[model samples]
Target chain A: MAKNKRDGTFYINPYLGGVLLGLVLFGTYYITGRGLGASGAVKSSVVSAVHTIAPVHAEGNKYYSKFLSDDASPMSNWLVFEVIGVIVGGFLSGTLYGRLKFIVEHSPKITGRTRLIAALAGGILFGVGSQFARGCTSGAALSGMAVLSASGIITMMAIFGSAYLFSWIFKKLWI
Target chain B: MVGPLIPMGVIPETWNNVIALLLGVGFGFSLEASGFSSSRKIMGTFFGYDFVVLRVFFTAAITAMTGIFYFDYMGWMDASMLYINPYYVMSAIIGGIIMGFGFALGGFCPGTSFTGVAIGKIDAMFFSGGLFIGVFIFSELYPLFQGLYNSHNLGGAKIYELLGMRDTVFAFLLIVVAVGMFYGAAFVEKKVTKVEY
Candidate 1:
């Protein structure tokens, strides 16, 4: 029988999973003197693509220019490398768990088209939001909370608080 | 040698990217193994039918925090050297709200979305593509939001300092709160109707 993702017991114990994730985070700090990040890779990719397409335009932009440097390519970002590894690791887990099928996951109430549109909208907002907060949930919230940073704590509160309220509003999206 | 061995020159600088890749492997494996690759599983936290996200997230936070604290106390690592995200009060709050909005709609964060893509979820691919476009839009419109983005900067502020609590005291309280949430989450999960994805 295929293991259902929703079953609380199908996956690794939450506490154990947390410890593994926490250890990875702790290791990240110990080794890199930094936390893990996700959205940053997207930032780097955007900068690199822009820089490649229009050097002058990219350099002229205040936001993109901040990442421009003569000595290094924005594509050589640490987060980019880490994200590649994330793909490999996720693949490994999916293989082990038999979740390697190509599919669109959605609530029965919604069509796949609806899920796609919502996913796209959500991703865009997250991209825009992470730039403002200077980090995403992983970088600012989880990583920050590990160090007990004021901004991280505040961002965590705001993200969860807002999401909790909105989830209710978007009740049909999930169930 | 200090714990942040790379900066301390205990580890060669050339290995930086290599280590990043390694750390990411562990990070991804943990998230996926924990069922984070599934959007429905993650959305469960908000729905009250499942508290896995809360359990995993808080447990991870406290676990790492505890490790850092103990390591710092032991003089095994220089916690002060760790990169603290700057507190841009207004921006952090506003940005977090926006990200939260995205979270509810998409059912995935940037990190989790990647894992979903790795597992071949089509919706995750759309989400990831949208991230690129969204970032591009933000960069193009940077001039308009620059003021709001950079406003109210507090440099590397710690939560304990902001809250007027000792570091140890705050850490202890966080642990207590996380544990309480775990229990409360279980209570809520039991009460709510389960939804099959």
Candidate 2:
């Protein structure tokens, strides 16, 4: 079987990758007056979809209504467009580096089904957490840290701290 | 002229979305290039085999923090206009802890998962589907969680203010800390038994 192009070997130096990521983040803040975000776009999409299908239900909800406005669809917001660019930019990078492929990435110890199940469950938890926190890792934690926000610092520490313990419990799943 | 472009009008409002797309391109390119698109590579941090997450995250944070301070000193941008994450102390920490567990299990955050999707990872696609479902769930249940979510508001508080330190001092300390962690990551990567993914 052919190996996954991105999985087989050679990754760029970590520090160089860091520098590049830093520059991107800095650029994001400089231009937008805000940092990069990912989960918010998904939240917006969900709100839009819910509103479309069940406007009454959406309007009745406290969470969905905060994002809704009479002048514009929540789905048409900046984060949504930025997320679209993320897909495009990521694809371009993969193509450029020969890293695009179809495969299920998992620990050798687990079946693809198990990995997928875990992935789904994890995503759900992340989704809920991000909504409550007002942002996900990229949006709340990382971006917040960039501006030295107190919330950002707290979130960053909590995430790494919690994940360290959780990762140990799930050791068999990864290593 | 010490920070945000849009609010300060250093850049016009019309360019916001356009610049957002361009900035996102840069953001996506960086994440993909850093191997964030791969679940195994991302999970490597938790396993002690790879520390890319720590490296990229801290470096980016410290770099941007320093740059913002520098720009403020130089009067290139208005730092005050930039958005800071509001400090809802309990909610932020609790939410982070939950997100952390999700990350350890799922191996992809929302942004990286999108990158994974771009590279045709069906698992990422599923993860994103789950994200939407989870968001919907949260929205529906917002009344139950609203109190916790909005609790203990600190109103865009800064770490420097909290610590009663000069902004530059805080920023410098962060750089030093990031550098130390980078070295630590290198050391650990060398010591750990190599896990081929």
DockQ (Cα-based) per candidate? 0.83, 0.73
| TM (chain A), candidate 2 | 0.91
Best by TM-score: 1
User: Judged by lDDT, which candidate is best?
Assistant: 1
RMSD of each: 2.1, 2.6
lDDT of 1 by residue, B111-152 (tens): 989999998999999999888988999999999999999888
Docking class of 2: medium
TM-scores of the candidates are 0.96, 0.95
- Cα error, residue A135 of model 1, in Å, equals 0.7
Model 2 residue runs over 4 Å out of place are: A1-8, A70-76, B1-3
Docking verdict class for candidate 1: high
